[model samples]
Target: MTAIYSIFGRISETIEKLAAIHRLLPWILAFALLLPLPQILSALFNDYYIYLANKICIFILLSVGLNIVKGFCGQVTVGHVGLYAIGAVSSALISLHFGWSFWLAFPIGILAAGLAGIVVGLPSVRLEGAYLALATLGLGESVRIMIAVTPLFGSSTGLLSIPAPTIGSFTFDSYTNYYYLVLAAAMIGIYLSFSILRSATGRAFMAVREDTVAAAVHGVNVTKYKLLAFVISALYAGAAGGLFAHMPPGYIHHNNFTIIEMVTLLLMIVLGGIGHIWGGIIGAIIVTIIYDQTLEFYFYQPLLFGLTMVLIVIFMPRGIGGMIDRYLATKKFIASQEEKSNAAS
Candidate 1:
C-alpha cells in the first residue's frame, strides 16, 4: 500500500503541475480526445458503438441528477425516471400534436419536469427516508401507468414520428450528428454539476444531508435546499429525456421509463460512489458497457444489478469514487510525511 501510494503521489504531483500551467488544459485535452470517439468507434467497431455512446451520455445525465438528490442532498427519490418520461412525452407531444419545433418543445419539457419535481418534492417536506422513497416510487410508477393508459400520451402505440431537432438548414438526424448533440449537453451538464457542487448552495446541501436539524439550526433552510436539489436533478433528467426523444427515429414508450430503468440509474451511482463528483459519469460508462455486453442475459439483468448494488453497499460503502478519493488522500499524506521527515533531519 505504501509503495502504491508513493507512485500515485508522484503521478498526482505531475498532473497538478500540468493543470497549474493552464486551468482549462485538462478539460481541453479531454474534449479533444472525446470528440473523436464516435468516428473511432464507427471505424473500429460499428455505428452500434456510437449508439451505445449516446446511451451512455444520456444515462450519465440521469445518474448525475440522481446523485444530486440521493447522494448529496440525502433525499431518497425513486421517481426521477417519471420526470424523464414526462420530459420525453411532453416534448414529443408538443412536436407531434401542437406542431411546435423540437427546439421550442425541449425547454418546455425541462420546465414541465421541474414542475413535477415540485410535486414529488412536496411530499418530502412531510416525509423522510422510506416514506419519501415510497412516495417517489409511487409517483414514478403512476407516470408510467398514465402514459400506458392515456390515448393522448400515445397509449400502447407509443409516440412515434417525432421530428429531429433542427437549426436553420441542418437537422440532427444522423447517429453521428445526434451523438454530438447529446455529448455537448452531457458535457455542459457535468460542468454545471461540478459548479453547483462547489458553490455555497452545494455546501448547504451537504450540511442538510449530514444533519437536517443541525442545518436548520444554522439557518440553512433545509426544506428549500431539498426542493432545489429535486428541481435541479429533474432538470437534468428532463434534458436527457428530451434529447432521447428528439434522436433520429424519435419515439418513446411507456416501458422505457419504468422502475427497472430507475433501478439501473441507482446501480450506476452506487457503482461510481454516491457522493463523489465523477461517480455518476464513471458508473454510467461502465454499467452501459457491461449491460450491452451482457444483452444475452437480459432476463437476469435486474437481479444481477440488484445483487451488485447490495455487494457494493455492504463491502464498499463509498463506491469506486470513494476508493479513489481515499487512495489520493493516502498518497498526499505519505508525501507530506516524507517532506516532514526530510525537513526534521
Candidate 2:
C-alpha cells in the first residue's frame, strides 16, 4: 500500500508540474490516454470490461457529486438519488416524447435536476444531524415512489429505447463506442470538482462544514453556500443520470435509483475517505468492481454491503484514501527530519 501511494504521489507531482504549463493540460492528457481504454480492454479481456468501465465512470460522477455536498460541505443528504432520478426521467422523457436529440435533452435534464436540488437543499437551512438525513431520505424515496406509481414516469415498466447519442454518420450504439462519452464526462466532472475544491467557494464550503455558525459569523452566507453545494452536486448527478439513461442498454427504472443504490453510493465515499478529493473516484472503482464480482451471491449482497460499511467505519475509519494521506504526511515528516539531522551533522 505504501509503495502504491508512493507511486500515486509521484504521478500527482508530475501532474502538478504539467499544471505549470497549462491548467487543463493534465486533464487533456488523461482523456487522451484513457481514450484507447476501450480497444485495450477488448484486446486483453472482453467488451464486458468496457461496459464495466462505463458503469464505473457513471458512478464516479455520482459519487463525486455526492461527495461535494456530503464530504466537502458536511451536509447529511440521503436524497441525492432523488435528484439523479429527476435527471434520468426528465432526459428520457424529453428524448422519448419530444423527439429531442441526446445532446439537447442531456443539458435540459441536468437543468431540471439542478432546479430540484434547491428544493432538496431547503431543509438544510434549519435542520441538522439525523433530522436533516431523514428529511433528505424522505425526499429521495418519494421520487422513487412517484416514478413507480405514475405511468407517465414509466411506472413499473421503466423508460425504454432511450436514444443513444449520435453525430453525423456516427452513432454511439455500442459499449465500446459509448465508453468515450461517459469517460469524457467523468474526466470533466473530476476536473471541475478539483476546480471547486481549490476555489474561494470551496473554502467557504469547508468553512460551513467546519462550523455553520462560525461561517455565518464570518460573513460567508452559510445558507447560500449550503444550497450552492447541493445545486452543484445535483448538476453532476444530472450529467451522470443523463449518461446512464443513454448508455447502450438505454433504460432506467425506479429500482435503479432506490435506497439500496443510495446506500451503495454512500459506501463508496465512506470506504474511500469522506473528505478526500479522490475518495469518490477510488471508492466508486473499488465498490463497483467488488459488486460486479459478487453478483452470484445476489441474495446476500445488501447484507454484505452493510457489513462492509460497518467494518470499514469501525476499524478503518479513515479509509484507504485517508491511509494514503497519512502515508504521504509521514513520508514528508521523515524527509524533513532527515534534512534537519544532516544539517546539524
For lDDT, the strongest prediction is 2
lDDT of each: 0.89, 0.93
RMSD of each: 2.3, 1.1
Model 1 has how many clashing residue pairs?
0
Question: Taking the candidates one at a time, how many backbone clashes does each contain?
Answer: 0, 0
Q: Candidate 1, residues 97-202: lDDT per residue as tens digits?
A: 9999988999999999999999988888889999999999999999999999999998999999999998899899988888888888888888788778989989
Give the poorly placed runs of model 2, Cα more than 4 Å off: none
lDDT (tens digit, per residue) of candidate 2 on 1-345: 667988878987899899999999999999999999999999999989999999999999999899899888999999989999999999999999999999999999999999999999999999998999999999999999999999998999999999999988799999998998999999989999999999999999999999998998999999999999999999998998899999978899999999989999999999998877687799999999999999999999989999999999998898777888888788889999999999999
Model 1 spans with C-alpha error above 4 angstroms: 1-25
Ten contiguous residues with the weakest lDDT in model 1: 4-13
Span of ten consecutive residues with least summed lDDT in model 2: 1-10
